[model samples]
Target: MQTMLTTLILGATIAAAAPLTARSLVSDAAGQTYDYIVVGCGVSGLVVSSRLSENEDVTVLCLEAGALDHYEDDILVPYYIGLQPDGFYEWGIYTVPQTQLDGESRHIPMGKGVGGGSLINGMVWNRGNQESFNAWNDVGNSGWGWNALLPYFEKSETYTPKNYSGAEVQPELQNPSVHGTSGPVQVSYPNYYWPQTNNWFEALHELGIPTSAEPNEGLSAGGYFLPLDIDPINQTRSDARRSYYDPIIARTNFNVQDNSQVTRVLFDTSDNLTATGVEFATGASAPRQTVYARREVILAAGAIHSPQLLELSGIGQSSILEPLGITVLQNLPGVGNNLQDHGMIHLNYNYTSPVLADVNDFAINATFNDESAAEYYGSKTGPWTAKPSCAVAFPSLEQVTESASSMLAAASSAAYNLPSTYDDEPTLQAGYERQMASVLSELANENIPAFENLNNNAGGLDLALMRPLSRGTTHITSTDPFTTPSVDPRWLVHSFDYDVMILAMQVNQRILNTDAIKYLGPSYEYIPQDATAEELGQILLSGIGTEYHYSCTTAMLPLDLGGVVNEVLMVYGTNNLRVVDTGIFPMVPGSHLQAVAYGVAEKAADIIKAAQ
Candidate 1:
């Protein structure tokens, strides 16, 4: 019973795998002078390079530390989304022992290859709530509100509606005006869904949470079926390299170097402090080489590396640099401060018996996995074409907690404070004051989501902290560029963060008892049932992870507000140097950051183009 949609998608395998012309070796790119040099060829760098190269006279160069992307099934097939691709696609970064998590270090998964996180992330395509983006504007960044950023969000993705589906698996679309019809990134609905998806949505509805038909319309406060970045036609990942680079990479003006790590940005010896070029090396032992940037050097090296690079180049806090015996070029204390991430706690269940109509068999029986693989290879319409969880929702504090009014009241007042480090720095404290106001306001408003929940249809859920009050820092412990940076996310340090997490866990427990989803015969696998708040808090400390939504390390705000970059994304006291990555975010928005990353990069390209 193959449908016509499957036939069309099967015909479109490897649609754009043509050879690219970007320089593959550092030797080829070294000593080369380009109009613009973009560091770290991830999501933001690729888009900036491609958009700038549109002008035939302007030359753009992209430098990536990892090797070029390999389109293997492990990297692209949606079925394998649960297992992270380590060593090749990710940086393999981990945090220092968290004091609040009982001295246990956590892995910080970041992208390494060309497409960056777009290649390794679960392809959940959704946008931030309107209130969150509006907070960005309210905090002094002009032209960055939801209204201003919507065009870029629409301009980045070309939506393709689901052509064929069973009624249960189909999703509702937002208005055509909110989506782009001819953008580069291919965004579409998966051809399949989980077994108990209907029951899951029904359960949320029964609890008074609505189903969001258009989660991308600046309003995503309820349950919605998330889309994937997979190209429906090719039945494979449509990552940044494929969507933004490969098609135009063969252009003579656009050149890229893989397997090259930028050690530092080279600035002129003059008082203006203009960036002249960058020093890069293929490996730690290899000879470092210089590549000149005639106009500008853009740092799109993501949240972790961007701050590391800035500090390595002597543009960070004087206190942090002077201790490491490095001269400070700028005294910006906010270079590696204001770090934020969405901490998640997972609750899984084991079924009492086998259900033939579900995907649970694929996890236990090896033979079932083989059968599913065979079917996926034969015709692209099997369980392998979908992520482990596509049903996601954003719930307000009122939806997840019984004490929303009291919690919001405490958060809004001076009842609690961030970690002590935030108070020591006056600039950081002022900036956090604004962020605290925005997040607390969102927590009180029912239209804004306070947390995110992902349902795997196996009676399991991942509750993520959307508006965390805890703040942390990421800094370089050594002067050696090859050494790993010190990353401290400070998870659950603030009392309210744990309070909300414990409440969210209780809500997940309640969801399992709902009449709509109770028929699954669910039994707890990891989370405790009928446990007191103290017991739940201890378990959360033992096994908490994040959604990998890292941002705000090199935040964008006013100079006096502990900001590393300004409204134009230009670093303070520097000329011709900009950061156009998620690192520039003032706070982690209340959604998966992939869609917003695309929108931010698109808008940044326009801003950079206009500046010239």
Candidate 2:
């Protein structure tokens, strides 16, 4: 008995003497062992780590390049969304001069701090449309339909309704069962607004649009309401760190290292890709060191960096990596393909009344009266809890194009006094087709100028294509993990993408014309009232801005189609390496991306656990 006891004690002492690198708040490879190593402390990483560490034996290490964040004054204030850019927390990635947009580069604000983009974003919380998820299932991403992901959405959320008063003023949250009763994230709606924002909703209804109680309920058709992405108790932005990380910091098995940037994924020589460990830098003054992952390595570096990391680790396009001296492990051509983002545009309105002036103040909030919207939110009411977009309108491009073509044919028949058999007459039909194309293009362009002419203070509707068919590629310029790879999203690369944006702009124009919103948008300002459709098209092409919702860098398609991961989110060639970030999104959702990102991560955690 004495011998056995001594042996056990000696073994523990040796383990104790071993490096505590995993637990080391500041690791210099002192010692540590973990069942799973998750890279990036962003929303996905935080959720994955928290869920993976639930098992007592499965020790999880979460490595973050940034540190803990405080909801600072400017960040907490609703109107201060723009303050984060050029600030410390944003990575501030800019586009490589867009050819279509006068060779001008645009700023793409990416969150570099602890909570990831959630810390710096506009705090809009709309779960993309159900059709989007259904399409995913249809596209071979089985089990990703709206029905399958509903539970996960609830599991990660704590619904906070808007704080509006009066019976007609508030929105109703229809189904309580759809919302998770207990979740880490505190979702709330603010209690205040500029007072006149509801007029915008009224305008939508007058225009024949319906008011949606919960936009997150899988339908994002059209409505006016504040979005929910805040903590009602404190009136602060509800970031992922606050939701998932802060609550689990006390767990002994879960370790987190901030300010540690992972540079590479270490692998053995067998050519068998098992993520052995990671090399990271502590700080400017600290030396880079390696930290081992005993079981598996998960990359949650987001869309931009996930593919970059895969390429750095020899799991991406060989032609690009090999030229730069990167040893290719898996030549996945789809490392960065099918990139998509929302296209944004502003139509400012110079209010005739003093209505909007009150909103300029940070303390001022939007109000919502519906019991459900307010109740689900922490009593903060009004439009203040809503996302910047009070309404989302989904229009089908396929339908619009067909209708436009038919209209052009009809118009030609009437103008030329042609016979009804125009469809049978090839020459006449061809002429009608050409005229129709020209006229549609002109009409599409004409919508932009109408928006510019309305309201002054820059109140233009942002037109984000629910889904863009244009696909671009993401490739690494080098094998170096620390360096950012050459990313060519090829925005507006295809004509269909151009048409999608044009259609979205036209849709917004129609919304403005609707009696429900006419007062909110008064008059178009920027474009000339007499501007032709061709002229409007030029303006849209030149003036449009990005919505900052980038995805599809490391797409999830079948292995044969150059997908980086299989259906289970595993890299095609590796057994233990997985990716759970925005990089895995097969396509961009039709609404705000934050909630959907959380939902995806929630499901990913379960998959990871089951595999273990």
* Global lDDT of each candidate: 0.81, 0.62
Model 1 lDDT on a 0 to 1 scale? 0.81
- Candidate 1 residues 1-612, lDDT tens each? 224443343333443443455544334889899999999998999988999999998999999998886565556677767665357588888898987787888988888888898888888888878889888888889989999999999899998867334434355555678888888999986666656787788888878877776777867587877777878765677788788887886688888889899999999959667999999999999999999998999999999999999999999977789899987988888988888999987777655546534556566765656656666666666676765567877888776667898987766654444555455678988888888888888778877888788887776687899899888888999988899999888877777788888888877877877887777777876655687888888889987877888899889889778899999999999989999999999988989998899999999999899988
Q: Which lDDT tens digits does candidate 2 get at residues 1-612?
A: 123332233222211112222233545342565788899988899988999999988888888887656445344545346644465577656666667656776776678777788877777776766766665665557888899989999998888565456423354454566777588877766655444555555655565545556656765355535356776655556678767876676788888888888877878747767788887786645676778888889999888877777777777765567788887787776676555666665544333443454333322222312222233233434443432433334433332344545443443444332223232434333433333343333333211111111111224455554544444555666555555555555566545555556655555565566664555444556654445567657876776666667786777766554466777888887878889988887767767688888988999999999988
Q: Which ten residues in a row have the lowest lDDT in candidate 2?
A: 446-455
Report how far residue 316 has shifted in candidate 1, in Å: 0.9
Runs with alpha carbons beyond 4 Å of true place in candidate 1: 1-26, 163-170, 413-423
Best by TM-score: 1
Clash pairs, candidate 1, are none
